[model samples]
Target chain A: MTINPYHDKRLQWVAYAIFFALLALVPILLDDAFLLNQLSTFGVYGILALSLSLCWGFGGILNLGQGIAFGLGAYGMAMTMQMQSQDIDTNPIPPFMLNNALESLPMIWEPFWNTGTGIFLAVAIPTLYCLIFGALMFQARVSGPFFAIMTLAMLSAFYTVFIDLQPYTNGVNGISPPMPLEVGSLVVDPYSTTSYWIVYAVLLLSTVVAKLLTQSKFGLIVRAQNNDPERVRFLGYNVAVYETLIYAISGCMAALAGMCFTFLTQYVSPSQFDVGFSISIVIWAAIGGRGSLLWAIMGAFIVQGAQSYLGDEFLNTWILILGFFFILVVRFLPGGLAGLVELILGKLPNMSKQQKSPGEKPVDKASLKEA
Target chain B: MAGVLEIQNLQKNFDAVKVINDFSMDVIELTLCCLVGPNGAGKTTTMDLITGRQKPTSGSVTFRGHVITGENEQMIARRGLGRKFQIPAVFRELTVRQNLEVAYSHEVNALKNIFSFSSRQCDARIDEVAEQVGLQERLAVIAGTLSHGETQWLEIGMVLMQDPALLLLDEPVAGMTEQEIEKTADILNTMKKTKTLIVVEHDMGFVREIADIVTVMHMGSLLAQGTIQEIETNQQVRDVYLGTEDH
Candidate 1:
């Protein structure tokens, strides 16, 4: 069987190269630290959208409270950064802990004292949380909107638990580390060009790797599971396992983005646990065209950047503008930005790798009966 | 030798309605058995019970000497039982070849096959299955864009890819034209040497062409069972199932 035209590998790789090359040019052209930092944070948002697009779009597992995982990742990094600011020979206490009148660093906060383990845990905790949560949901046969609501419920749980844990979580103030993360001699200054490029480079790599994955044989089954899960199950696949596996991966990616957010922003706040943040991540995927990873990332950049830039205005018209785009996207652009691109590409001559045979009509019954 | 399939006094109830009642049947290897019954005759439900889609209220389903009753669909299928639904259940967004590739796999482990590409052996097998189902040319075509008849054939093709010993096909030719139906019949007839298939159909003409053994059900109970000629002439079967051959 010939490779389908939609998954033309060479074309896809070339597109990725072009997209990232253009994005990488941004840091070179400008030296403004504040602007660069904001753009890097937006890159983190793109990564979050990319994660959701994979799980919900290709993998067909919708998560409504993905922000909880992001919040966890942020905290994972924040914990380490906080410990970095501490003098272990002296007090070794975070500002949040000081405010709460804690005499000693809690036992649970010990691991975060090391920067390396903290980075690893930043991705790991959320990944494990999702692996466990998704396994439970899929095994119990909870899916569709029920799965969505269940995840939202989990997000509510995280919000409540984190906000109530005055000692560990700082009770809603979250953690703002006094200094940047220091791994030996290197300090990961949030506003530096190096940090901006790191975020940019990671997003680029993530997009390409995730794109390759969605095009692989595993991706084939993921799409199959998305389209007809029962059919996939009867064909000898553990449909729940597939969904759970991908959900964990999505969790890992979001957590990575959250880790990067800590590196870019120098802080983790309760706002990461906000339901609207998670919903916004979903919205970015929806508007960007959840079907295509690149488009979804673009959607995140466009919507999040616009909201950021325009939200600063006194009028606060950004929400209305975002609502309009959301309506336009959902009402007509069902495939999101990717669908629009495909529609245009399908119209252009020589756009597709394979051309239809001349006068070869679809093999409908009428034609076969006529024959 | 053990039969390919054994359903011992299987019963399924949805709430208060007994969908399948005390139904028992044994299928030998390589038999193209047709289950013909009217609408809501429990033909589909029996398939469901055998494939682990529905949990039987009582009794057991054994396949190839293994007790598969109450096992999940994934596990049952892994035990070499493949199935097709009444409506074509192929992955719509994927190409015909991709759908076949998914079913043709022996790699059931998700992590093992994540980075794996289509092997030469896998591609050759997919091509062979595509040709068998008259979809060799349409392998690259998106399943969603395929015609109704083509989709049915695609589902059958998917089942064949698993290379299962027994296949449960529910109304395999429900929405096909005469020529398409004939083509489908040819495909099923060709698989009789290595595969055991239990097809549920309403069309007498299609059943007459493909069935080696016919089991007739009426209102969730077995009405009659015999060869085509014996079943066609059976007065009881005629009264409930063959009463109107035009179906």
Candidate 2:
């Protein structure tokens, strides 16, 4: 029997609703401050995974320097909060500036003092960096594994720069506001319910935005490029522009997630831009299912939750266990958790058929079965 | 009829191996021209050069009396040059309707494309292209699930959606069944009224069926250009191309 395509679409939306509903229940069930903080981290990382899914999963551009965007966002917001804590009458200089024995406030740090400017810079900085980087790289036709390597190198460079600039950036220790986040008169504590709600709101909004983007014409074109970029070019789409735009969007989303992370954790650090963290972000997306944004986000939550559990009980062996699981998932369920669900539900077509891309020889079903 | 596409002395070399050597052709408006050549005769490369998929070492490609030589593939496509690859290059994961929808150029703005999608008018256009390609019933089917012949037709439909002035097809009916080939021929024949087509094919019979004029190439150079009968009767073409086919 032919499945109604609309029914499948409805079913997907239902899955999304259930996922969101479960996320909503997390706060209600966990009254503990530590658990709420942990849950907030999961929410933030979910957005990060979603960002990766948008770039690598759909656009076929692997950005291993995603943390650079995230770090920039966190720092942008952190600087604003730090400047906010400055006394207008007695002492204008922030604690970090005074600690560095700066005679005057740095002109470079002035713009981020405004809440609006800080938020704008948080999103704009990464978006602009990605646009410039993507324009140069894609124009040169540097993509796939080469792009990944370039991004990784750039991330390492960004980390070193952050570390070397100790006076300005606070070096390896990172930037943290001395006071709570203040919106006009209300003080938003990092561990408070209000802070948790802020992260949740952004997470929910990002999820919806991501869903809409992937369903749009632009998303289809990006996915099309992933399969055959030359074909997209022949179809009247500037593949480089599409790839660049998607990469930039991913960067912006990563920035937003980073801002959320800073709001929850009350800190920003150079360690976030490390190559290992970038790889971990990729793993979250890989584990969930890069093919779908929602799956990627869920994958982040699942992996992080597992990490917390493993870290609490078996700190040393958690890494080993996760590594084993990653290998199994990569080998057996290449599509990740979402793909496994898709398989069980018979949503996907024959594996061999789906694998048989243009110009590729189709695998023999008989041989596959026998093997 | 006026010439819609003119390729003059097009030369392309991959390192030392010359793919298209001083190849030239004038494709008249609203004509189905078949490009027939042996296995490494640079027929596809010629199409690539014209469509701007591959940059020529030395050549000039003029579309409607304007020099489009060395233009990017997307730029050439925007100039009304639509090309279908040797492999069925439809977005396999997308539905048949979506395949045509993406090919349609109603909303060219990438940013706007992200927000507001194609209008209801595009649906009607997609239906028309689907009908033309005989994939109307398979509109809901994913391109990946379609048979090889259907995938070929879906790609042809995608090209039609663009309403291109010049359509270059590379081995469109390569692995099609006889029925599918006849259907494709019918589709091409219908399109011939409004579009200029340069179809590269190995099947001489299919060429004879749809081609108004045929060009035969050998060793990256034009060997013959004439009617199907003229090509079959030409002694040089027979010796270089059809002569070896008996084996």
lDDT of 2 by residue, B131-171 (tens): 88888898878789999999998888889888899899999
- What is the C-alpha lDDT profile of model 2 across A1-371, one tens digit per residue? 24443324444555577667777887788888887888888889999999999899889898899999998888888887887888656777877767888877778787877877877887899889999999999998898999999999999999999999888888898888888767778677777777788888888887777777777889878888887887888888888888899999899889988887887777889998989899989899989888777878888999999888767798888878888888998999877887775564353345433232111111222324655
lDDT of 2 at A108: 73
> What docking tier does model 1 reach?
medium
DockQ for candidate 1, please give it: 0.65
Against the native chain B, each candidate's TM-score is 0.97, 0.97
- What is the alpha-carbon RMSD of candidate 1 to the true structure? 5.7
Q: Model 2 chain A, poorest ten-residue lDDT window?
A: A356-365
Cα displacement (angstroms), candidate 1, residue A317, comes to: 1.9
lDDT by residue for model 1 (A249-368), tens:
888888889988987878787789888889889899999888878778888998878777777882567777777888898899988877776665556575343332111112211233
TM-score of chain B of 1: 0.97
Cα lDDT for residue A127, candidate 1:
94
